[model samples]
Structure formats: structure tokens, C-alpha cells
Target: MTFPIRTPDDLHIEKRDLKFGRDDAPPRWWHSNDPGRTAFFNALSSTFPVGEKFFMTAVRHYRDGTAEPLRSQIDDFLYQESMHSREHVVFNRQAQDAGFDIASAEDRARRTIAWAKRRSPIQQLAGTCALEHFTATLAHDALANPEHLGGASNEARRMWQWHAIEEIEHKAVAFDTYLHATRTMTPFRRWLKRSVVMILTSLRFHYVIFRNTADLLRQDGRNDWATWKGLLAWLYGRKGLMRAMGLSIFTYIKPGFHPWEIDDRSLLKDALRLLEAGKPKEMAA
Candidate 1:
């Protein structure tokens, strides 16, 4: 609703050291027992470890000169991201044990991160900002609309919902860091660089997710047209997660876009409540 809403002063982006799927392995088709849906989410999970590291690297490059509130937010962002990567590492292992080839998916993510590391710091931050927007929007959708993951097992659902909550909490850290890093650039140039990078980032992001999903599905022996059709429909059909997020995703390219302008904290609060409720009893205490 507004052009800017700083990360809530009272909202601490906590480093939740929670674990998921440590004791019980979710079924191979963890999301509604559907191979397409399962592979799609598994593909996304495969990228988190390396991808979050790159995000931290890019944001951390600009940390020194950042102002107070944002500096504190950056520290919290790094902590939350580290935890995300760690949990996803465990979740990816579960997918691997479920008979999918996670090594290749992780390798794909590593290669992308390696390539991104070669770019200038500001460019890399711009890329991080782009990807953060994508993640934040998807996270908001997943949390705001429960049916997106309604049928998933408790552990898997809680894992994803927890990730979504923190994502919404610190969604703007990368974008804010990018803006501060490029403060010297002309306004037009700043906009141009971020907008262009968002385009490039979207292309690469989609390619990796879809390609990895296809690769995983192939391992399940269902990479044919029929399987792809189901996957496509799951993502792009009516009531689809991606379809639901289309407009929110496009908001990133607006001239003066800020992640908080949409104000989805209500979703964050609800999801956080559910995640806390689902925690192990000892942890909850």
C-alpha cells in the first residue's frame, strides 16, 4: 500500500534453529502423493543451500557501510539464511534417499552460484534482489493460501511453512542492500540495472527449477509428455501456485518497488503461528 515500510522495528528476524524430517522420512511423493508436485518442490529445495549462500555473500559485501537498522537486519538476514540452508540440506537428503538424484540438482545450483560469483558485487546483489523478490512472492502465496501445500505431510508442510515465514520476515534485506550498494549510481541507472537483472534472474531461475524437476521426474521414470503436462498444469493451471503469484511477481519491476509495499505480514503471522504449534514439544517449551 505504501512505497516503503521498513522492516518492523519490533519484528526481530530470529534465527530459528529448528530441524525437520530428522526422525521420520516423508513418503517419496510428500506433496499429496503426486510425483509432479513432489518433484517440483524437491527441485526448489535442492537450490536453497548454495543459493542462500550466494545471497548472503552478495548482501554481506555491502554490510560495512550500511546504516544502523538495516545493518542489524542484514545480520539477522544472514542468520536466518544460514538456518534455511541447513534445514534444506537435510530435506534434500531425504529427497535423495527417496530415490531422486539430488546430487545433479545440487550440482546445477552450485554451477549457477559459481557463475554468479564472477560478476561485480553490485551486479550480484542485484541478482540476489531479483531472486529474493521471487522467493518472497512465492512464500507469501504459499502461506497466504494454505491450499497450495494443504495436502503435504505435517513435517514437509511445517518445513516449508517455516521457510516461508522467515522469507517474508527478511524479504527486503537483499533489495535494501542492493539499493545502498548502488547509492552512487544515477536513479535511472539504478532502476535499469535492477530491472534488467530481474529479467535475467527470472530466466535462469525458471530454467533451473523446471530442468531440475524434469531431471528428478526422469529418475522416477515419468519424464514423458504426460508427466510434464501434469507438472505444467499444477504450476500454471487455475488455482496453481505460480498462476496465483503472477501479479505479485511482476511488481518487482515497478519504478520504485519495495518489497514491503504489499504488506503481507498477516500471512507471516499466521504461518509462524502454525509452525510454532507444530514444533516438537521440547522445542516448543
Candidate 2:
């Protein structure tokens, strides 16, 4: 459930055409009816639409010279990321209706991505590789542990489920692109660069996600000690998300690490089921 270490030479990358029906907005604490958990997911969504563009840019930088199947996969990756960004924009607007600071969150996300673009191309790809892992780990967990989305509104849950599925589908593209683009660097140097960036990326994400979560929760009047205590428990308690995600993050340090090495593609069954359930009748095959 934790590690996502698997790849196939003939991996089929398909864009899922699914729609979440949101005729009416859900409560502000849409996640399981808990402000803290809701804040966590909202904070993540706030960043996803804007931040994923940087991911596409990093992959595109090195994808031009890739061989046949990977070239096609990279194209699919670009398309999926564009779709993901757009979907999250819709999701964020819903959060805005709930009084969350969408403008401030967008500002922070853009500033973060802008800073990342200023780094060397290799570094930018390294950061993207790291982020892909972060998201893929989360996606794997959501599929493996249904409780993660237990309290979510149907529409919101469907969007995240769909997003998670696509994240897992193309989990290795950025890393593969990184290797293709960094032929000039020695293996050891490349490892060092990626390892260092993953560490920093982890820290920066932790800080920003929670900072945004706290801010959003405050706006929702979830400022009590009981709320913070319950939220912290949900994050760090046994089988909490951060704990589940840690192994995947640390695995990047292993020699000859490939994302597919920790294969959890079996989890895709659940994701596929969700996709099937969410497809518009017109788009249903």
C-alpha cells in the first residue's frame, strides 16, 4: 500500500474522460465532515492545479529525444497533467465558495512553482520527480485504504479518485525523463542531486500544505484545541498518511531506485472502478 515501485515497458497510458457531478456545493468541511481533514485535502487541491504545470514543463524538457513508447507516454502525461490542473481549478473554486482563501493559496502555489522554474533544469526535473512520488504515494494509499476518502462528498471524492488514478498511471514519467535528460551527469552526481532535492521538496511541501491547512481551518472557525488534536492524530496516528508515505519518500535514496520497484499497480483496480462509475453516460464505452 505504501511503496509504488513498478513499471512495464509497454505501459498503457490512457486519458480517463470522467466527470464529477457537483450541482450543489458541499459543506465547508466536506471531507468526512471534519474541518482538519477537510483542510488537509483542500490545501493539497489548492496547490495541485497550479503546481502541476511545472511538472509538465520538467517532463517536456527531456521527453523530446525519448524512444518510441516512452515518447507516446510522455505525450499522455502532458495531456493528463493539463486535465488534472483544469479539474483542480474547478475543485478549488468550490473551496472558494466555502470561504477558503483561494486567491492566497493560488498566490503561494504560483510563487512556489516560479521559484522552482528558476532552478537548473535538472533540479527542476528532480523536484518534479520527487513530487510525482509524493502524489503517487498518496494516490496508492487512497486506493488501498478506502477510509482515506470515507467522509468526502461524492463529487469531491470522485475528482480526487480520478486524479489519483492518473497520478499512479504516469508515476514514473518524470523520473524516466530525468534519467534521459541527465546523460551528462555521472550516476552518482545525478543521485546526489535528486536525493538532495527530494529532501528539500519534502520539507517545503510539508510546511506549505500544513500552513495553508491551518490558515484555511482558521477561516472556517476550527481554531479550538480539540480540533487541532484530532487533526494531528489523523495525520500522525497509526496508519496515518504521513507515516504511510514516509517509506516511499525515503526509498528514493536507494541505489538504482526506480519508482516501479515498489509496485502497487494492483491498487489500480479500485481506481479503475471509480473511473468506470464516474464516466458520463455519453462517454461510457
**TM-score of each model, paired residue for residue:** 0.94, 0.92
Model 2, stretches more than 4 Å misplaced?
Answer: 1-6, 278-285
TM-score of 1: 0.94
Encode model 2's per-residue lDDT on 1-285: one tens digit a residue: 112223685457778655554576878889888889999898898999878988988889877778766677899999999989888888888888887886776778888898998999889999999999999988888877888887898778878888888888899888877777776778899889889999999988888888788788888788678888998888777867876677777788787899888666677776787757766565576
Q: Tens-digit lDDT track for model 1 on 6-79?
A: 66666778777888889989999999988989999999999999999999989998899888888889999999
- How far in Å is the alpha carbon of 267 misplaced in model 2? 1.0
| Model 1 clashes, total count | 0
Query: What TM-score would you give candidate 2 relative to the actual structure?
Result: 0.92
- Return the top candidate by TM-score: 1
